[model samples]
Target chain A: MGLQRGVCVIGAGMTRFHHKIHKDKSGRELFVEAALEAMESVDKGIERKDIQALFVGYFTPSLYEHQGHIGPLVTDWMGLTPITGWRTETACASSIAAFMTGVLAIASGWYDVVMVGGVEKMTALPTEGVTDALSVAADDDYEIPAGATFPGLYALLAQAYFKKYNMTWEDLQAIPIKNHHNGALNPKAQFQEEIMDIAKRIGQREGVTFKDPLDFLKSKYNRVIAWPLRLFDCCPISDGAAVAILAAEDVAKKFTDTPIRVAGIGFGTDTLALHDRISLTSFASAVFASRQAYKMAGIEPKDVDVVEVHDCFSIAEVIATEDLGLFERGEGLKAAVEGRTALDGDRPVNPSGGLKCKGHPVGATGAAMIHELWKQLRGEAGKRQIPDAEIGLAHNVGGTGASCGVVILRR
Target chain B: MVSGSAAQFLTKTFYDKLKEGKLIGCRCKKCNFVMIPPRLLCKECGSKDLELVEFKGTGTLETFTVIHVPPMRLKNVAPYVTGIVKLDEGPMIMGRIVGVDPNKPEELRMGQRMQMEVIEEDGKPVLAFKPVS
Candidate 1:
């Protein structure tokens, strides 16, 4: 909305998301790896000189890696020297913001070609340290003072949603099961095994067994992180990177044979603290952003044959689908149970296993969602690909929806 | 005290007041819109003519959650209950829900009358609520 020039993603790439796989690697290293892959992905070939700007998203490098000025740092690491660059931050949606910023840069005719990506080396921090770092996304004063943990915040949303819709905890488990199933197909996903496989493997190790995935999930082994939200319900702390190359629409084909058009992109915001929201059950920011994006794209939610949503927690996926108008408020809770969001389902959501399975490296998440959509549109997505997907959407929420960004891509 | 902007200082004043058994809100002189965790300027009308006003400290529980795994600073006090309370003064605020079984969340219901109180944590006053049964 900020710029008039049309833009499209020419290439996209990412590293395998994980908790410890990138232990020997830094955020910059992961970023370069994804960037190099993206460079190699352009069908017509691309060089470092072709990229005129750099937009990166990293949640907290100063805290995660004791590093700052990550924009030029990563630019230099990628061998794209002397180009103007800046880092974007909006909690987990940082990378989506970067991608939108890149769109603006290209659309403004300020730059012909630009690189947008997100990286977060979150595994370096201990659990609580990670929690503390992420909390900065929420209201620092009221939320932290009230002991509102990230999980606790979403848990509160889950409770409110359940109360409003009369849904049970069992109805929500379908999300992880479906996401894990999709994740099992993704080579780059953090958790590549189904809940059944994980249950068996971990059970064998702990000398405990279960009747099924649901039984295993119900067990204390998947103990509550927050009431009504168990361990499996929360996304893991991961270290990874995702990058997308964007070019003006006219020049897009020069780089890639099948450029995914940036159809509609919009950003929205709400009060930082969950308490400040008018309703706990929905994020008005997400709804506003999605509506703006739809109007820009000139396509309804029905046109989105596939989508990748910010599922930092399970309840989020439901809220997002509802907020984005993909499903009615109460219907989103049952979408998973009804198998409507499956990869083979009519409207596949998060075919890349979403943030829950693909891994949520905060800053990398938004870009990764776009990466999945790109693959789906190009028919590059192998197992999790939705059939004949023409348009797709990525919804990224910052904190408990304090900041939100939506991007719709069309093939 | 967490050090930051003057706006944050004004917010910290809200906590300082809580420690002294007071519930304060910043009321705009123009529109009379109140910001509970006080603000430097009125969000509604952008009026700088704002003053702290005392609230009845009584409200209804809007929603709640029992934190099973808290952050590092709160790890010692794991399994604390947090909730959003709609203040009778017309703003919602977040605080710990004390004097209730955090595990038995069923015991708490939405719209239940709640009263604000302060509990000491790390020598700082933390805001909390208790159901008025």
Candidate 2:
């Protein structure tokens, strides 16, 4: 079955995802900033009174900001009070769920227009506090009791992949390097400098020299957070928000002459712990969710021109490409190593530099992906634009492989 | 037949058995699927008809990683090895790997036989595994 009444994205906007830049801003302010940008993005301009409702995806507000009841809180902040508003949570995929909820509400003929977005004020806490807060998404009784951190959970997947494919840790470095190159071109990204540039700058200050990015990565500067997964291999914590405006398909043109149609929406969940799954080489939730989305969209993996998958870690991107059927199993890493997943590659992935360099504000990541896709499809993604991008997809996952959401959009 | 209903297959029960020098799991009476850290329902067939079962404390190392940065509670035990072991009883579980050098991960081999051992961390009983030469 398909959407009863179609929904289209008329406008989207996001703040530059970074750690230090948004240090003083709270989640409410970050969301309002993104919402204002989204309002400005509307071609014909829409008013707050015209919007029917609101749906937000903000994970760990209580832990990060020591606040709850953020749905009405953000609604009031945006001056859209008295309109029904609420929040959704699925760990990192929270906003995708919110976006899908907005889609369903419109498709069900309940509302003609709605605003969907995600926000996270992660920098409010220290690194360790953030880590503890995020780990709550996992199986607390099982996974966390075994001393598994986020990096360590992914490290296990990398280890299994290396053993099955006979690859090495050095093979995964291409991901961070390529993402950094893409991030350099994205003003909204957290780390805007290339890996080699950062390496050289650090080397000059530390009284050390390196031959290249790989050499610098192998040095002590990139200390191992988990064996086979170093500092650069992990995404840094950042604070940001993303907002998108959705309109019923028939009335989409009232706000914009050109609107991106929501082609497909799919979400799936698996066991929380990795040990309970059939295999560690791939995320079954992503596979299941993407398959459903492709079927509903009536398209094949080859039809996707550009994509933004969750790259919370380098190896995660590798597994995501495979799970989405963009690359064959055990071939994702090789694709990255060969520049096939670069901005100018045959199968371009994460044109926003991914969560790796774009920065992972956790809750904001899912909608931020949609923000990138909207820019790409509209020929508005300035430097990292994929030429003539027609069909775009976004894959978002929660803790480990427990939850996933796959969304497809077309111009 | 193992005593107690599916209610006995709780988290505290599993850890208590480990503290008593016994490694226990649960088997679905309907599907015969075994799972570690005992659960009330079977993941394979959605059957609550489960019974407690004892393991021989042996398995094969499936995958592993050395955690150089651990959670706050595990801060004192940084740079420790954690892995998933495919137990002989047909279910896999995650635990710490001891009796080996955490820094030298290249020395470890997949498919190597392992023996389960109970260890204390943060004043709580935690499962651990050691390589069986």
Candidate 3:
């Protein structure tokens, strides 16, 4: 069935994702910055009062920022209080969940124009504390209690992938290197400089010489956090915000003539514990969500012109590509090493640098992914633009692939 | 001195059995799905008919990861391999890989035959898997 009413993304915005102390600013402040930027992106801007609803996504705000009731807090800061505002939490895919809700609300004829935003201020906690907080999204009874952190969990996936595909640690480095290369061109990316640059600087500082990027990657400083997965392979603990303005297709043109239509949307959830999954190489949530989204869009994986898949860790991108049906099972790593996912490659994946380099702000990651696709589909992506891009897709996944949201956008 | 939280209860049971060289799983009555960590409910049918069944201590390596930087409790045993093994009784279990080098990939192939054995860690019988000889 078609969306009862059409929903189109008219504007998008994001705050540079970074690690911020609570003393600097709160998560609400970061959301406001992104929301304001989104408002400015609209060609024919409407008054903030005209916004009918707001969807906000945040993870561990109560623990990280010591803030609760974030829904009203963000609306109050945006001066949209008294308007309907709700908080959506699904770990890293929280914002995408909120975005999907906003889309459904418009399609259901409940709200004509809605402002969807996601924010996370998690860097306020120390590294150990943050890891503990994020672990709550996983199956606490099985995973966390077994001394499984996020990295450890993903490292398991990495190990499985390596075993199944006969890959090496050096192959994994290709992901971070590519993402960093793209991130260097992105002004909003957290790790803007390539890791090789960092490696060179460290070598110079220590009066030593690195054989190559892989050599530096293997060193103790960049030592493995999980076996076969190094510190560089994991996404950083980040703080940031992102927002998008969605409107019914009838009213979307009023805001902008070049609105990106929400062609399809799908979401799915799977077993919280990794042990319950039948296969570690593919996320069932992503596979199911992609199937639903593709069916609704009346397209296949081959139709997507550009893509933004969750690369929370390097191995995740490999898994996501296979789960999304972009490549054959157990072949995503080979694609990455072969330069098939590069911006200039035939299929450009994560031109936004992905979470690997773009920075994952948990709550904001999903919406931020959509924001990148919107820009790419509209030919607005400055340096990392995909050539001849028309149809774009974004896949946002939550803790350990428990939840996933996939959306297709077409210009 | 054992914490009696619900999360720890099953692991405690497993630990108690580990001391006796037994690996246990919960077999579901509704779907016959066996949970390796011994869950309270069946994942496939959502049934709570769980019977603790001891595995045959033999399985195949489904996948694995070599951890270079272990957590605080595992730091002393850094550079160890952890993997999911598909047991003969039809369930996947995650545990450390013993009796193998962590750095070599040629030794850890998918679907490689393996067998489980109990090892002492901190004076507790912890279960680990080794490549079949």
DockQ, each predicted model: 0.78, 0.85, 0.37
| Model 3 residue A344 distance off true place after TM-score fit, in angstroms | 0.7
| lDDT per residue as tens, model 3, A1-411 | 558888999999999887643238788899999999999999898789879999999978888977889899988999998999989999989999999989988999999999997998877887767777787888754454345667878988887777678897799888898898889888888888888898989999988778888889989779767766788899988888999999999998889889999999999999887877878888999999999999989999999999999998899999999999999997888999999998888778899889988899899999999889888988888999887788999999999899999999999
The prediction achieving the highest TM-score against the true structure is 2
Q: What share of the true interface contacts does candidate 2 keep?
A: 0.81
If the candidates were sorted by their DockQ against the true structure, best first, what order would they fall in? 2, 1, 3
Q: What DockQ was computed for model 3? A: 0.37
Docking class of 3: acceptable
Q: Lowest summed lDDT over 10 consecutive residues: which window, candidate 2 chain A?
A: A138-147
Question: Which of 1 and 2 is ahead in TM-score?
Answer: 2
Worst 10 residues of 2 chain B by lDDT: B1-10
Name model 2 segments beyond 4 Å from true: none
Residue A59, candidate 1: C-alpha displacement in angstroms? 0.5
| TM-score, every prediction | 0.96, 0.98, 0.89
Candidate number of the best DockQ: 2
Query: Residues B18-126, candidate 1, lDDT per residue (tens digit)?
Result: 8898887777778989778778888789888777778888999988888888888888888888999999989999999998987787888888999988898889888
- State the local distance difference test value for candidate 3: 0.85
Question: Which TM-score does chain B of candidate 3 obtain?
Answer: 0.83
**Candidate 1 lDDT by residue in tens digits, A38-79:** 888888999999999999999999999999999999989978
